[model samples]
Target: MTRKVDYLFLRKGSQNWHLKLQYPGDLGQKIGRKRIEKSLGTPDRAQAEILALPYIQEHKMHLLHGHKDFRIVWKHRFEPGRQHVGPAGERIIATDRELIYLDPQGVITKRAPNGDHFIPVPPLLEQKAAVRREQLRRRGVRNSDDSIIDTYLKHANVTGYNEREARAVWSLYKELTNGKPLREATREDGRKIVQYFEDNGLKSATIQKKVGWLNAAINLAIGETKLSFNPFSAIVPKRTDSERRLPLSEADMKLVRAGMEQLDRRDQLLLRFLATTGARLSEAFEIESELMERGCRYVIIGRKTPQSHRRVPLPAAVLPFLPRQIDGQQFQGTARSASKRLNRFLDDIGITDPRKVIHSLRHRAQDRLRAAGCPIDYRWALLGHEEKTVAEGYGLGFPVPALKRWIDKIGF
Candidate 1:
């Protein structure tokens, strides 16, 4: 005869709980309960215990009837109501059971029974549900593991970023992915990534640009991929005003001239040419006598723009300072070294603002031309700049004498 018994399934290796049952078969076989465990996408031992209850009750009845087959026992006990068996024959009895599975913290997930499937309420969702739940429970929330990170990298193709700039963005994204849930990422997290670069000695401008690109990637994840949110929108960098135009004052110009006087003849000529022609430091360094002799009155400023390589009329004031034969050889020093030397010279002459070095002379020339009411088009041309209007309209061939007249007015 089959005897029904109420049995509680404590997970395998679980202690402090026992399944009580009565059966007609051998007492040893019916009394000694086997451990029942279930895998339900959770790590909590309590969840395993709770999920095994119905299976345990069914198994105990089968054992009492001298039945040793688990598959048949499961089919009779838990399989009638459910379509799927839990991992190890422990069937989920109540899919909608309000049983709370607590992590180390008091965080709890209420497992509710769906039509044919058991749905687990994730911790994050539980938090939202708790606000409306009559009873509140606390539980530990586990961050997304490294698996999520692997997923991000796999889809992002981060390894394919070949440019240094693109690679830098990917590196920062990788750093942010450390055990963080894709949904938990915030704009503050993006700010910290930008700050990491700044604190590590990257320039502020570069940090700003890199952070912007990182935000773009985060947006991509949110909009194009499966990520739930973009966390970069909240970061606000500290703003500092920058001065691109560093025109030298009259006193600063005098100091610079005095400093040039102290340099050797060739170096002095280079300095004078830079000051008078307003040529970029690199363009001045690359000047050749033959190029200058071909009526190339102006040296192009190639570093900033393609149009920057246009000719400005040769400033006659600069003629006195030109080398008899232009040193066909380019200047040997790097831009940084040249800037440092120029700064040292300025410092010696009591110019406190180091910005008044070589480039400041270019600013000063532009200022002088503007102050004299020189046409904006002419000034732009002299500076090798594209005009705001049609490019061809701006006189490509500036009259040498007219340019000289403007230079004479400046009286450098």
Candidate 2:
């Protein structure tokens, strides 16, 4: 039996489930897609749901870390004077002077001057072959010549999302160490990297994150590559008391409300959603459309972190301007673009304080809750904060009506 999935829609005359994802606002123009649709190739509801998971995850990943083109790197090998088989099982009768070719669709063929058909290698084939050659070259490298950063990165067990962050750390480490091999890197090399960040005036948090990523990579290499001590181990950054940014103030909120008229409809809705619901910018933008279908009643916020995932009731004052779900997403554009536009609007509206930014609206919501005398437990649950004690984690935090009661207390 088939059940309905939010993004999986069945055409009127078709049984196969199809995924239709629409990018929000300017995101469509940037990603080169107003919407992307793909067939799930399943009539059974359960199988369709299962097949949709990867597509949904990929879409969400793109939302978090801008869009990237999708391509599958095909690996093909051809030897001269020997019969070779292609991915699709097409037999290529090789000649001694044969030249291998590949097409855009990843099909491999051979060309021979001895009256054999001339198969043109697609440009994509050359790109894939170059990558294959690099892999082969890396495999041939001895431990003495192998780069610590490169080796650890190649073998690092990171997800597609985190891979980008890991590589970014590798880029910095490679530059700092001048591409030094694992065997050659000293603890001083690690110190040099930290000192470079400090010299460049990077924030303590940013420095810690980059160093931590490199440290973890080296640690992984130690276990798998049988290296000695991690050069980055035991090199922790000292904690610093950073100036806390003021949450959205009463005057800041007024200025934003006044400036709301200048923003686009979508931006306006996003601001109101954040101000009313107190959702993180990412949480509000990437929230699932299926989670927004309570008929303007409430919206559920879910993120990678369990503590940040919770159900937030929609305030009635802001209901008239609530955003409509497009495709499977509640809002359009992206969190990044939305933040930029909102901050710019804030600057224009005379809210020039760096301590008060777009996120201050979320702070205003907390203030409203606190001023209304909402309980601490309710505040924590509504804001998706982690449980403070064992008792708070015992059951479902609160009923929707109970959550709604506190939400109603938040006057827009």
- Scored by lDDT, the top model is 2
Candidate 2, pairs of clashing residues: 2-45, 24-332, 24-333, 25-333, 248-360
Q: Stretches of candidate 2 above 4 Å error?
A: 1-163, 220-228, 234-236, 292-296, 323-327, 386-393
Candidate 2 lDDT score relative to the true structure? 0.69
How well is each residue in 316-398 modelled by candidate 1, as lDDT tens digits?
Answer: 67666655545565455655567677667777778777455668888887888889898876676666674334563455556
Largest TM-score belongs to which candidate? 2
Candidate 1, poorest ten consecutive residues by summed lDDT = 68-77
**Looking at model 2, which ten-residue stretch has the lowest summed lDDT?**
67-76
- For candidate 1, give the lDDT of residue 216: 55
Clash count per candidate: 9, 5
**Which lDDT value does model 1 have at 99?**
25
- List where candidate 1 sits over 4 angstroms from the true fold: 1-193, 200-240, 243-246, 286-296, 325-330, 386-389, 392-397
**Cα error of candidate 1 at position 173, Å:** 9.1
